[model samples]
Target: MPLDTEFSVTVMGLGYIGLPTAAVIARTGAMVTGVDVTPAVVETINSGRVHIEEVDLDGLVSGVVARGNLKASLTVAAADVFVIAVPTPFTDAHQPDITFVLDAARAVARVLKTGDTVILESTSPVGTTEKVRDLIAELRPDLTMPGRNRPGEQADIAIAYCPERVLPGRILVELIDNDRVIGGITPRCARKALAFYRRFVRGACVTTTARAAEMTKLTENAFRDVNIAFANELSLVADTLGVDVWEVIRLANRHPRVNILSPGPGVGGHCIAVDPWFLVAADPANTPLIRTAREVNDGKTDHVIARATAMVEAQPPGQPVACLGLAFKANIDDFRESPALKVAQALAERFGPRIHIVEPYATTLPPAIAATGAVLTDIDTALETCAAMVVLVDHDIFRSVPLDERRGKTVLDTRGLWPDQA
Candidate 1:
């Protein structure tokens, strides 16, 4: 390996994944230029402000800017390394939408120089890196690529697939801490990519072919989806039997080898809920567990919605119901694929103008949430005004709220993080 004084790194897309990775690279003493199509995000980063809601991101961005190792741009500039962390959302038919990744590849291709390494960090279909390499080669035919037999006949660019396995709120810690899997189109590709991550990655870089790397990421999440679906399915069965699923899980997991995941309203996130579908969509016959898990999770939102509606129906018609928390999970302000949001929306729609929502972490809601006729209010106001309480997320604020304080209200705890004392 070669020791260089400065590595010019360009990160495409300044969303949750890109921003944190760019900031971390800069923190490791690399010159990182972050590129985003959004002018507001670009401006915010340049001013040392963070638009995302991750913990410690603002400070990280501030530190990176203060050291002059990080900057934001709307266009890509020449760099020794380029990290493509763009979005890979699905289409209406639930197929892999690689438009953003392709655009990012093309963007980097324009400024790509000899000896530059491009790492595709997005969760994608198999052969995605090869597709990116082909896209780059198409744009810059002047560049020579490494032939299978002759490693010496290498191209101006090298490509690898290194998918991120970080949670949204824990991106900063996980980026360096989690064991990474690096898959290169060639053996040389894998080594170069591993070298880049070694600067900050405390975890080991497991090498493999690019297809395996891509499928490994997909399989990791699919495994989670399958396990959670099992728990969810068991929860439904336990619900029918009038048995506490959490208690059942506790007893079952007491055995020497059982490791059961806790059941929630549903699985929700940019990754777990979405990525499994990519595999099932690709090879439906081979991925029955993945398909079933997705079905179980997707079906959970409706189950929660029904439960909330039933709880509301049991109350008087004019009763004001308080919905505690709006984010997908606990303590954070992410609403993407949140079953809590669906339950709240269902209740608000069913109750119509009678839903008093108290999401202490989030003051204003997006348009979709605002359309549900929910009155966003302070926790105290929501508790004081509403007759029924529905605890969605186990946020610290909701945990801090005493059950004794909620005397007259009917509390339906979805997370079961709190006790319901009548």
Candidate 2:
């Protein structure tokens, strides 16, 4: 059954995923308290505004705040449900770091009540949710905790793992429309968590063990990473043979069984670029393909940087090179694990003031790029002045530039933005 309107929810980490999630849940008439350690984020959401960019999120947050269905805070508050949606960034050595997830769980445990449902929405390695269950068991021994050992037994507080599968621009719709995989430490725990999601989600909510859900999330991303690696590797091979990769893909994809993903500078976003590593790290000996795919995708960035460098170096010494877009993908402001940013930053570090960056979404240059003397200019200035251009991201604004206007400029289009120019 769907949860009642009177049931409350508290979301930890009011970031890209968390904020949208909080606003979406709030729209369902459930009172929501969004928690974040960042003061700016809390203040922004409380002011009926959004800290991050997403389609229609500003109005939704503003409406929910105005309607008194949502509020923001720095500390965790007592609620019928707690959703941990924090980051699970990997370490420098590519190990899965669940520090944020565990921290959020700790905060929830402090204020946890007998009937509260704790759901972890963070994309994590397998066994992360169980760690949350074990941590809660250790912290609050007074309350009974569910586990495989206690199988099917009722627990004071229900705990589950529920990872979101959302595209950047369509998070709000997907958050509700996407089928959810709700995995619990126990079967009863999964049922308890399902009621909360059932209130808003229009799609089916499948139930399973917590470990399976975690692996499912990782598998989904890893599968994409592997496929993207194939596309990226094909792009490299096509370049070696002086063949048009886009043309090759277009012809190949005409076959009924063939469906090749578009190749980019590299794999990116918080999920595809990071989650696959979790699976690889979990068991290195058994994951040769997954590990190599990660390596290939990462290497594609280095390859991009090299080719872009050559393009810039070919220009006259005094002439600047315009490096377009910084976001991981087109039309989005998110730069998390973005290969485009890596390429831009590398090129800027090499040529310094000779690199002019055009990112319509970014107001200020990333510190690394700006510190190296790369100037942030509009597309007009870049087109007018720079003799060489490297298209890192295929943003709509960049794609609209006509072939006639860029006639005299030397172009290296990584994203296949302007086919005529290519």
Candidate 3:
């Protein structure tokens, strides 16, 4: 299908995934309106400035906004297509919560027309897309809906699930080039969404049932969580045997058939750390491996906290201990489910003002850490003043520090970033 420049797209939740998707769709000449609840976010994007950080996203959003193709608003309006990209975060019991998804669906329902297509791009549990279809049907009984009506019959509107499959740092490129799985309540619904995505995506858009699409995303993240757990378990075993985990992994990976992932303090981010639990929660009896992986990953954070605190306790009384990097992974400011932040918080709670944090991405310490009297400082200041150091995140700046500069400092390198202790 050729690009439809006249199509109007309204994307809910203009955060990590939504903003980028809206910007890229606008780049294809579609008039895109990004819907976000935050007033600051709405004002920032309308002025061609971004509130969040993503590579090349600011330029893309600015370009699209300047061309009058993209805008941000606090309310949903009439559009040809509606994309719900809100956060489907879990509840206190780790059960998959679809409150945000349903809220977006209700908002979309208010302005839904006969020919509009609604796509759920948020990562959700199985059957969420069908739930969306049901919600819309209840909101607007005049128009027929797909999946609820006869199989061969076409409905007034199309609804589908198309989960995002992109890394945080490379979302802009992946949004255009990555293959997407478009699954709908019915075959016709799938075709309609495929047509919309084909307008901007260079990669293949495969069609399937809505249930399969939701499960596919969960499987992808669960697979990663399981593999990372193996590496993290190995790191624990290596420490017990007095062997360097990084060196062991390097030698073990020399075998052509064997490929092992590097272990960190723990698996973080919204996906790997949280998605596996959805599987376990859905089928507690059958998902033993998934449950174990989640436990191991969660345990790794506790292990890091124990080790870092032990090092801090061994130091002289009142000596500051530097905790480096609070972001979930390297080179990103996202701290969702970050093990580094947990470890830093534990250290601050244990030693009060003696915990010095060096997160290059954050301008100020989080209020909780700040309330504990932790000081957020630069890498040089941390190295010069702190008696002990814990490398929680392997950021580029932390890796570039010379080995000699770390001499005479009590260091617990959880990432194994500084293998050579000079």
Model 1 stretches astray by more than 4 angstroms = 1-5, 146-152, 419-422
Better of 1 and 2 by TM-score: 2
Candidate 3, residue 15: lDDT: 91
User: What digit string (tens of lDDT, one per residue) describes model 2 on residues 158-185?
Assistant: 9999999999989999998999999988
TM-scores of the candidates are 0.95, 0.98, 0.98
lDDT of model 3 at position 27: 86
Q: Which consecutive 10 residues in model 2 have the weakest lDDT in total?
A: 146-155
Scored against the true structure, residue 250 in model 3 reaches a CA lDDT of 99
Q: What local lDDT does model 2 show for residue 49?
A: 94
Off by over 4 Å in 3: 1-5
**Model 3 C-alpha lDDT per residue in residues 44-107, reported as the tens digit of each score:** 9999999878999999999999999999999998999999999988888989999999999999
Clashing pairs for predicted structure model 3, backbone only: none
lDDT of 1 by residue, 111-221 (tens): 877888999999998888999998888888877653333545765567899999998778899998999999988878888999899988999899988999999999999
